[model samples]
Target: MNAHPLAPIPDADVDAFWRDGVICLRGLFDADWIEHMRAAVEDDLAHPGPLAREYATQAGQRFLGDIGAWAVKPGLRKYVEESPAAEIAARMLRSRKVNFLYDQLFVKEPGTAAVTPWHQDGPYWPVQGDQILSIWLALDDVTVQSSGVEYIKGSHRWGREFRPIHFGGDTEAYKMLPGETLPDIDAIRREPGSGGLEIVNWDMKAGDCLLHHSMTVHGAPGNASSTQRRRAYATRWTGDDVVYAPRNGQASITIDKPTIQPGEPIDCAVFPRLWPRPQDSSLA
Candidate 1:
């Protein structure tokens, strides 16, 4: 499989990423990668990793989540290192280099009614930087009825990190960084004269993906479709500005503590450098 994007990322898409804090790039990944992820997702469902979770849901519904699969799953590791994802992230972030931070899986079985609450991805990690983001690759066709994620357009420029939302887990390890409390988004929408807070989502195909800022407030409804499954593979990537800064109450996703010191570039064994290939000494 070619490890490069089938088409060059257009300048408009890059502008959208910076202006709106999110962009849905279509047909970026070839069919080969999508099938590989589908197989990996099935295997992960059967034998979940340490951080795998079965979130609370109503009867006949299932919401499964897992993180840091790249550390143990060869398929995911290959995708991170060999796919055009790193290049895409670097271009979107406008950074000269990039690093593979981690990967997460969100599987909402048909009829699942577990809603992902509104929250930002920035505060959930033990790092800090404006260049951090995630590429959410759909493993199956996705629609609003099938739990397609919705993003608060331009929320990343809000310049504030809301408290992380806890979804029925051991909250002991999940602590909040210094930030504003999460606003009642639903209530705000119900009231009049509310600031025009727009939410955006799209119908996505198996090979399409959404690139979103780390601070973009986003969430998704349950898999309301009775027969369609909603499975997505979200890979987090960091650019040159990101650094390791372990914090208390962070998401329990880092399988092992990074060997790098606080305030150091996240370029240790856990988060390896991806861009500027060693062979391409010219770029380096």
Candidate 2:
């Protein structure tokens, strides 16, 4: 197969993304796209369908929710299935084939004190390997005070599996292994740029995005900023080589009774290929 020669992914950026397992892409989507997605999010919030309960939180509080493609609001269909976002994921994975792992919305309400536990996205996911990628798009400005994402540099290479926790709130019920609590938040704050730990708070505009590998260790503190609302749309994708692997103790949410056995190809519709760069075209 001929490799499509698209615009070169910046060497520095690619190296950082591969080494640390995350890369922040500034102003990737334009204002129009951002507005469109924002509208979709609003619609979902207003009408919130069946899957809405999965994402719903108490009124006047921050929460995390997911609406599967089939259950997504009509306004979000195009963005969920085929959008500039999916195209970017396809390119980043360097795969002619791509799959939709899922779409999630992370909302940090003003004064919300919930913190996301430090964990790798891969452990919770059914797919294995480094084929997975996650795109986090901010719907509103994200600042450090508002509790934006902070990643552990090069933690993807740690190669040790940390316990998976509930995505929405802190809990020890899902801790599959003996895991240590993350170091003091205040200490982490003191050494923001120390020890090769490149902590990033984009304080991003609506269209800015952060792409990270599935194995990258990341977490966000509570939203303390009273001014800005920290809302984000996160989409995950997998490349050609990813396969289903049922964890011994974990329950599967997206799959039914584990159709994908360990070491089996992930051929389910939930994760369908979305894009393939033009092979013979001259777009590059």
Candidate 3:
């Protein structure tokens, strides 16, 4: 395990988040919350739901994935929007109103070569503005060799439209433009605490959460660990001033119909407000 930084989330973290578009919050969830979430994931895996899809895998090791409203499962609904995780999100977004965007579970089996493509979460989403955020909660120990998530700091500010890619394979989908260079993951891995243009991979435990902005550039490599499985629960949220935007050529199964246009309010039934943490309240 890497030595804990052990510093309060300073203005720099929030500044980095606003400037760079991503930040990591360590040990955010307690033991009970982690266990409950773990149990929920196991139950979802065992009793495969209708939404389960063979998550576009590369080799024989297939990953089970699901989407849409998580409220169907009592455990998932309670944990996704009402847990300590939500509180952290609320504080970060600095908005009293919090909503559930969606929840996804990615469990990479040992020997899986399927790689998640580098992309921003905002474009595929049907929301507008910079109020969106995603919380990636690790349910197991994640290491660089185990296909942990990699992020390009401040890449969220990079202005580019979302591009579709074929998941799990090395094809034209993973290809970059002729002159565009992919950020060096090796250099970031080597300089752990050197600072300046650093790439961060949190040596995360079961209860750690990484809060990322909508436009942050992030992707993970193939799982190389022999026996360890990487399980994650990804919860998305939005704050005030965010609206819905419809993008052409993008398809999302979670939404029934487009209620939010490119510049409309995201007050739809799908993204219902979860917590309105009152301002000046002792809780705040």
Candidate 4:
């Protein structure tokens, strides 16, 4: 229920997501939902679940994050199930049926400086196909200088896969997934013209979100600002083409004993169906 008269997402934005692999929406989430998500994040920070990890050092201060929190937090579950995010994902992916993948929480206290390595989400997870994307919702005012998720324009269309770098900077991703790949991002950024790669990011408010493709090249800079704290939640969604492809790669650890196979459609209690909301035109 868009009770706060949010701005309608433009058709152009949907097309942009399909073509460019990333799109940002403004004022899509209402105030109450933002507050609820913020509270939920605070709860998560206090009580991180099994997959939670404080990246780097928590001794003085550091970036704290975790994934698959919908199972642990009731408010987050309600937000994921009842909010407009699923519908928005369906519209962006041009999918009639969508599946809930998982929710990732990222919080950076003021003056925390830890750069997120440039990587794509698809190769890191076991899911297959291009119908999956993540909706990153911000609960605090985010600036490029503070905490911003940047994207490489049209990187999704490149049709190339790369190794995923762990945020902790210890594990070598290329060793896990062996393959010949493009040059390192640090190398690419140094080259002249960078082979048409264009990195972009936007200053976002509490209610703003970016729906980015699974294969899109993205990474966020650390919170360098002295007084700005960044709080955000990223909800991953999948469409009809996504399946339980545990063969090609390691399926998301959040999922346990999946009942499906590589080529089969992924539909289990863990990865619940989200879209095709029942019609309710009646006024109560």
Best by lDDT: 1
Question: lDDT for each of the candidates?
Answer: 0.86, 0.68, 0.69, 0.80
What's the lDDT for candidate 2?
Answer: 0.68
Clashing pairs in 1: 175-249
All models, RMSD in angstroms: 2.4, 4.8, 5.8, 2.7
Point out where model 3 deviates above 4 Å.
Answer: 1-10, 56-59, 168-198, 253-262, 277-284
lDDT of 4 by residue, 192-219 (tens): 9865689888989989998899989998
The C-alpha stretches of model 4 lying farther than 4 A from their native spots are 1-5, 172-174, 180-182, 247-252, 278-284
- Evaluate residue 129 in candidate 3 and report its C-alpha lDDT on the 0 to 100 scale: 71
Q: Which candidate would rank higher by lDDT, 2 or 4?
A: 4
Order candidates by lDDT, high to low: 1, 4, 3, 2
Q: Candidate 1 vs candidate 4: which has greater TM-score?
A: 1
Model 2 misplaced regions, further than 4 Å: 1-8, 49-59, 67-70, 168-172, 175-198, 248-261, 277-284
The CA-based lDDT of model 3 is what? 0.69
Count of steric clashes across candidates, in order: 1, 1, 4, 0
Q: Estimate the TM-score of every prediction.
A: 0.94, 0.81, 0.80, 0.91
Q: Which stretches of candidate 1 lie over 4 Å from their true place?
A: 169-176, 192-195, 280-284
Better of 2 and 3 by lDDT: 3
Pairs with steric clashes in candidate 3: 20-154, 244-261, 245-261, 245-262
